[model samples]
Target chain A: MQTTRTTPSRLAKRAHYDEATIHPILDEALFCTVSFAVDGQPMAIPTAFARKGNKLYIHGSVGSHFIRTIENGAPVCISVMLADGLVLAKSAFHHSVNYRSVVIFANAEKVTDEAECMEALALITDHLIPGRWDDLRPTTASEMRKTTVLVFSLAEASAKLRAGGPSDDPDDENRPTWAGVIPLQTVRQTPVPAPYNNDTPLPDYLINPQNT
Target chain B: MQTTRTTPSRLAKRAHYDEATIHPILDEALFCTVSFAVDGQPMAIPTAFARKGNKLYIHGSVGSHFIRTIENGAPVCISVMLADGLVLAKSAFHHSVNYRSVVIFANAEKVTDEAECMEALALITDHLIPGRWDDLRPTTASEMRKTTVLVFSLAEASAKLRAGGPSDDPDDENRPTWAGVIPLQTVRQTPVPAPYNNDTPLPDYLINPQNT
Candidate 1:
């Protein structure tokens, strides 16, 4: 989704609006720590999420305090960060990092329509693992009733990213200090069968990383 | 540090604590997003930090708006998160992540003593990359004048951690779907020499990960 001027805070800088740079980082992240105020107190809760198109969905228990507060139209801040590497610079002040992160500040609303909720659930399932929504049993009505799904339109969002190497000071260039980035990555491993699984064949999707 | 019961909200669940489970994860992490209110508006800033002896030190400009607010004894909520793996569950509701994170809610104060600030800075540098502080040039007086350091005692902190594979529904055990974790790691690579380095030798510390 395009970031508008109204929320310039959400705008992405440095190679701005490169879908190739944004989509993969957002899609690969599984947890987002949401920060918001409750009765004047600020609290952050880590929760699972699913993205569908440009909208991000987070589901929690209907009784969760965070869900209740957001349902009241309280402003919320949701952030997803991928720490790529540590940038060691010659100057302490210049020491930074190489990371890709997206922060969205929006008014969240609970999804009410059953059809929309189902679509959101499917989107979440597929977001977590591709090709799995059709392979497993669908969510029962009872389960959906107990869960509260909140939709955050990626309207006011900004992605601040730093990539490449260290920006050290010229004076310290001759200082015999190590300077480089420790590139970080996330990789899916072999699925661990449930304790009760009776040696069933591994799902084709699990066997093939490309499927995801 | 123990989380007291006076404010029950600060008392995290048992699963959130357990230093054995949380220390290594916290040490590996490089950044923390701190949230607080400024003039009734919420602001989250990403900053470098160092943890030593149950205290986390964050340094910034003395004139920084965030540091100014924190110096005034405003309630601060700091969160450090390390995403170990992405949990892809069978059901959307069950989908989660394997992560270790710590959240601290407390009052912060600016380090006023020059000696203490220097020691704290050393701790911060050592924490970021062990043995680097002694190897690099010391901070100049001008650098010290421009910097402000705030310490957050982890005494009131709560560590929350989740590890291992995904937790799926018992009924979905027989379903031919993939269920597992995608391991995530932060890896440091060879330092890229600055253009002005003119092919200087890489620091021994950077070449030896063990020193870090």
Candidate 2:
């Protein structure tokens, strides 16, 4: 939905409201930054997140300042960004970044029910490594007690995207500068087994994550 | 400068206050998310940033909603995060991401001086492509008029870093699940030239960025 807050006053052409444009950005991102106020001062903290339908979930230690300070129904902003490339232009003013980013404004709610909390935890784990959650040991009661999970509805969200090459002025086309895009991608390197991993073979899911 | 807000209530050991530990993370990140309140609600917007000494600079169109809403001395929280690896553990609760993140709580100040503003623009351009600014066409007066630059001091900044392999509990060590670190890295791919790029050869600076 295009609420007053979601609409941009400038460069309005890049804003997107549909889930088709927003969901991919959120799911592709391994983590997101949550913004909230304390004493009227805004703060942003980065943490892992997962999405189930239209709800996004984030968790932290029960004793975390962020988890404790954020009350139920408090307004928050969540943002996820994926930098795709560097847009090099002939002029300094035209230089830009090729990126896909999403911003959501919503009220945070604590997940207290045991079943919901457990499901969110599993979703988060599987989001990180698809199918790995089913293979892992079950969560213990102590572990559940130490975590604080928060959920936000993606009702008020918008996405902005910038892609392709630089948009330099026509006059600067003959400039000596090299103008093009240098693509950036998040890639997985060789997995390193733990010292006590017992020489278990690497899982195929980790080798090829769901998104990549 | 370990202030009350900079200290993490949990995992205090992961937080660091020295510039030696914080500066590299700031320099390595191409962009940062700035958090500020509008009508007592928090919002986070991501933008390109460049650091000069202890001051961080970000710029946007003068008419942007983010630029207009922010005042000269409004309290803002800026955060930069780089995901290093994924920690896959034997248990769901132990799954975590290895990352280096910094959060700063500071007041924002606008740059009105012509020389400083020009320098900041160049710094930002070069930060994206180290030597590209010097080779590009100079900025025009109109471009300067259209942009708004803001700066923040790093006095109250702190960085939290988590690295290495999974730290699963001893009881779950013998579980059949694979436990290790799946390293993640942002890498540069083949450059894509603009359709009207005039066939300019790629620069060596882009091939090997300073940090890489």
Candidate 3:
């Protein structure tokens, strides 16, 4: 859905509107920046998020300012970016980054229903760690009361991305400079167990998430 | 510089108002998300940025909607977040992330002076890969015209960070679930040479950036 607000005015070729291109980028990243205006001034805060079907969920302590400010159905922009690599070109002006980014525009609404809130909370937990939610103790009513859950539809969203080697001008290609991409990868390191652990073996999901 | 807007109302212990706490986080990250309102609707874009002294710089083609909209000295919110790890707790409500984040509210101004623009461009290039800027072909006047650079002051900025393992409740600490930190690290992969490379040796700056 390329609404008037979702389209990019420049470099239009890089913009994408279909869910095939947008949904994976949303699911892959662990967090996103939520942008909105309070009294005509803009503010952006980074928080963990999860995608459940066509809706995105984010939660925080009810007392947090970001949660309180945007829970009233304010227009918000949510952005997620995965930096792939640094694109080095023969010319200084051509230096760019290889990245996949999605920006979504929507009005956020609070989730007041208990079942939906619980499902959203579980979805968020499973989104971060595939099977960890059920393994942990069930959420108590007190914990549910202390948190605020906000939801936004992925109906009006767009993704823009750049990949591969540098696109240098023919004239600059022969220059005596090294040009290419230095790839960046985010890897999960060895997990550090908590001091009070009762020696529970590290879960296989944490070790082999791709299989999950 | 803890203005009403920059201050967080909850979990106040994590907030820091001084440059000693903010500047390093800004420098270590390669980019930030710029947030602003257009026609009363909020928009957020992720772009590469560099910090020089008390100012942060970002640029794009002059034809881009983001550049055209913000070049008029609009009020903007810039946010940088470095996700450290996933903090898994015994209770679902206690699960959180270890991260260092900084948010700044400032008015953006277009760089009109040629000297300052060139300096900012070079600073951004070097900021991404130290010593690579000087090796590339110099920027042409035409190239400068095609670019739009925006700057924001570091004043009115604050940083909030959380590190270490999960903080679970005393009652849940004895639960039979594994709790810990799954550290996330971004590492550079092998560089891929462009198709037209003249067999130029990969520079030390690219291979050993920490030494640079």
Recovery fraction of native interface contacts for candidate 1? 0.30
- The lDDT per prediction is 0.69, 0.87, 0.88
Worst 10 residues of 1 chain B by lDDT: B5-14
lDDT of 3 by residue, B1-212 (tens): 79999888878789999988899998888889999998779999888889987899999998888888888988999999998888999999999999999999999899999999999999889887889888988899999999988889998899999999999999998888999988877777788999888698898787753411
lDDT of 3 at B24: 91
Pairs with backbone N, CA or C atoms under 3 Å apart (clashes), candidate 2: none
What tens-digit string does per-residue lDDT give for candidate 2 at B1-212?
69999988879999999999999998888889999998789999998999998999999998888887775687999999998898988888888889999999998899999999999988888777778778876788999999999988999999999999999889888877788988888877778888888778878877653322
**Candidate 1 chain A: worst-modelled 10 consecutive residues by lDDT:** A3-12
Q: Which candidate is the best by DockQ?
A: 3
lDDT per residue (tens digit) for residues A1-212 in model 1: 44442233422354244455556767877667788765555667766677766778987777766688778667777877877767766666666667777767777888899998888777776776676677767788888998888898776666678888776666777666656565554455556654544565667666755422
Candidates sorted on DockQ, descending: 3, 2, 1
* Reference-based lDDT, residue A117, model 3: 93
Per-model B-chain TM-score: 0.87, 0.96, 0.96
Model 1 CAPRI rating: acceptable
Reference-based TM-score, model 3: 0.97
Q: What TM-score does model 2 achieve against the real structure?
A: 0.97
lDDT score, residue B66, model 2?
Answer: 88
